[model samples]
Target: MKSLRACVAALAIATLGVLASPAAPAQAYPSPGIECYTIIDSNGNPQIHCIAVGALQEIDWCKGCPWAISFKDDIVFPETFDIDVIQGVENLSLAAAAADPRVAARFHDAAIADFASAARGLGKQTASPGPVGVYDTAHRKFVADNQSWLAAAGQDLADGLALLQKSFGSRDSAALVKAATAEFDEAFKEISGKQVIGG
Candidate 1:
């Protein structure tokens, strides 16, 4: 019986050690395939970074959510290509997921956590992102870089998401999804396109 008690004590200490470990180290934004971001690097050059966070419920949930881009200064576009079609939507709960409004808020809440967690996932922004309207240099470069494939407003990833919000509210986001398919299909054909996230 004393041996059994010793075993239990060992298990408890092991559990505590695992629980008290330090958090993950910091990294860059807009992980690959899962999500994308276009930015002006500190060197005055354009940088397209698409990175993926681990399946962290609190962090990754917000990182790839519908409202994710609202968190970053340089977060210009959403990777609508794989995000909606393959990876992102499976995790998110649309506001209009059900016909009942009573549950919509619950869905939205569970799918998209608050900004505090987002801040943790995105970390503090030290670099100053220059000019930022619709015609800003970063945006212009993102456009010019991907002009051949992602050229039009219809194919604009962020705009596609705007339409998506309305469609979800109406519970018929077919057009929203349809709007981006052909263009992204062509995007896949471009060089290093699987890893190249942009525009």
Candidate 2:
């Protein structure tokens, strides 16, 4: 799942280097606005792959900027018979909170509500590997071993949400942003250590 970070980085590199082609005959660009795929695994089970390469497109739109970029290979496709991972599960909650108008407007009560929702989502077990696979044994063990750290990081995220509530109630946008950023930093640290998977 963390490999999505690599995908994002690759998307950035490709966007920076490539120039638009005109013969494709598209408005603004020739790239597809969205990309999705459906494929079958080795076990004959069907799987769908959809990558939100435009995850940050909302932010860009909010800032009055429309960046045309291709989002190819945005979703992970398993070539081997390994467990399929859900990438960016952890950050999705935070991204939702950050996108909330309450957080942007600095509304204390609404901010609390939005942040609490995100916190709750973050507190749950977000990563679970597939059940039947050759790598399942090791993957299961890896998940079991990292449970403690994952729980700790979840707690940190929840605590950070509480801090945001307090800061917002005090009407301190600077403090709120700083505290939220710090909480993210702490959560990153908690996950990036010896036991965690993604940094």
lDDT of each: 0.26, 0.32
Instruction: For residues 1-199, write the lDDT of model 2, one tens digit per residue.
Output: 3311111110111232222333622222233222222223334343333322222212221222111111122334334311111122223322322334444334333334444444334333222222110111212111112234344544454455555545544668668757765654454344334133233
lDDT of 1: 0.26
- Candidate with top lDDT is 2
Task: Give the clash count for each candidate.
Answer: 6, 0
In TM-score terms, which candidate is top?
2
TM-score of candidate 1 versus the correct structure, residues matched by position: 0.24
Candidate 2 local lDDT, residue 30: 33
- Worst ten-residue run, lDDT, model 2? 4-13
lDDT (10s digit) by residue, model 1, range 1-199 = 0100000000001111111212332211122223233333223333333323221211221222211111123432222321232222221213222334545445434423221122122223211112111113323221112223222311232343333344443555566445433232232222112222445
- Model 1 pairs whose backbones collide: 30-51, 31-50, 31-51, 31-52, 32-50, 32-51
